[model samples]
Target: MFDLPPWQSWEMFGACFYAVRINALLVLGLSTVTLGELLPGTMMSVKTRSISVELLPSRVFRCTDTFGASSPQRISRQGNPLETIDWTSGDWIAVNDDNGVGVDIFFTLKEAATDNVVVFVDQRKRQFGKFQPCHAKDYIDKLSVCPDFLVARGARFVGGIMDCVSPSNLEKFVVPDDCFILSQAGTELFTALWRIIQRVRLSSPSTRHAKPPSRQCFKAVRKKWIKSLGKL
Candidate 1:
């Protein structure tokens, strides 16, 4: 089977549960408020590029298994990829791999000299994939090809980010609404994280996560469907 690009393939939405500690720190003012929360009045004008990639069924399964599940009362077992992506790309100005190891994929715009952006996805080996509603439209004006689909033999949604020059005199450019920020904590966080980590660690490249509260297992040759933003 041919897998299209994940960006054009599915609309998967799941918050990274790992941000609980980071959120706690931010809430307590331990860390600098993410660039997204900077005072809007002092913001600057800088072109920003954001990419939202939906991991194929394989990648999503690995991630949820690594973090566990989401819960309100307890610290969420899930880790928020949004926050991680924002921190690596937005704050650090570099895409990061949050697999707790090293970054996997890296990308850069033609304008920038030094490639600072890095990207990662959580998934397993497959034929190919695709993505719809690509973010490339924001930057590119004239396009020879519309990124309605993405193709790859195997998809991996490990964590990563993109980096670029910090716009001067542009604090506004420094912050974005998309920055990862959410409040969650407690025993729930521990359970979720532990379970997820275990899931990813134990996952054989052939498995998938389809269970509930956070399914973390799947068959190698299966295609999963997720809700699209516009359709939902």
Candidate 2:
């Protein structure tokens, strides 16, 4: 049986850089073309007897098992285990922002696979609009639904504040292997950060005349957004 992606998640963006890179390289090195046997693992579901976890092109959906137990062996009323979610669906995920607060939230699948759902959570503090990490002892309200999204069996009902998308936009949907969908807050946070970076690009002496920083720089920041990842 092939290995399914781990259930765990990264607590920081810096940590994910190397994680994604290493996984991507491993995925690249696999050379499925030369090793045809790997295809079956890619084609089959690990949930039914087993699953395969591909790190390369490390998109969430590509790395996770779409087929899972309709009814999990165990589910806690106050906790969630929807780890290794599908990035293709723009699912919310956990990440430690530069602010030292953990940003985690996402929407879940609705009734069926085709009829999926989109949700956005208010992870910020009710009074201040600051992020409220589930790890913090003070975030009692969010602690109950600690880890927000649930990849439930049968996809009966999803929980969270649903996001609305126009019908015209629905027709143009594709899950690129390079990008992962994030929660609304996450999307906003990333957008804000990118805007800041853009401003820096326009004003910074080193980048003013030069092209935007190299891709490696972004990857470098991800590896060490909080600290550093040793390998390239």
Which numbered prediction scores highest in TM-score against the true structure? 2
What is candidate 2's lDDT per residue for 154-219, written digit by digit as tens?
A: 222211211111111212233222112222333333334334334533554433454333566456
Query: Which regions of candidate 2 fall more than 4 Å away from where they truly are?
Result: 1-10, 13-18, 21-23, 31-51, 59-150, 153-232
| Model 1 ranges off by over 4 Å | 1-13, 16-21, 30-118, 124-232
lDDT of each: 0.22, 0.26
Task: Name the best candidate (by lDDT).
Answer: 2
Clashing pairs in 2: 14-222, 46-50, 46-51, 90-181, 224-227
Given candidate 1, what's the lDDT at residue 11?
A: 16
TM-score of 1: 0.17
Give one digit per residue, the lDDT tens place, for model 1 in 88-142.
Answer: 2221112122332222212111112222222222221111221111221211211
Estimate the lDDT of model 1: 0.22
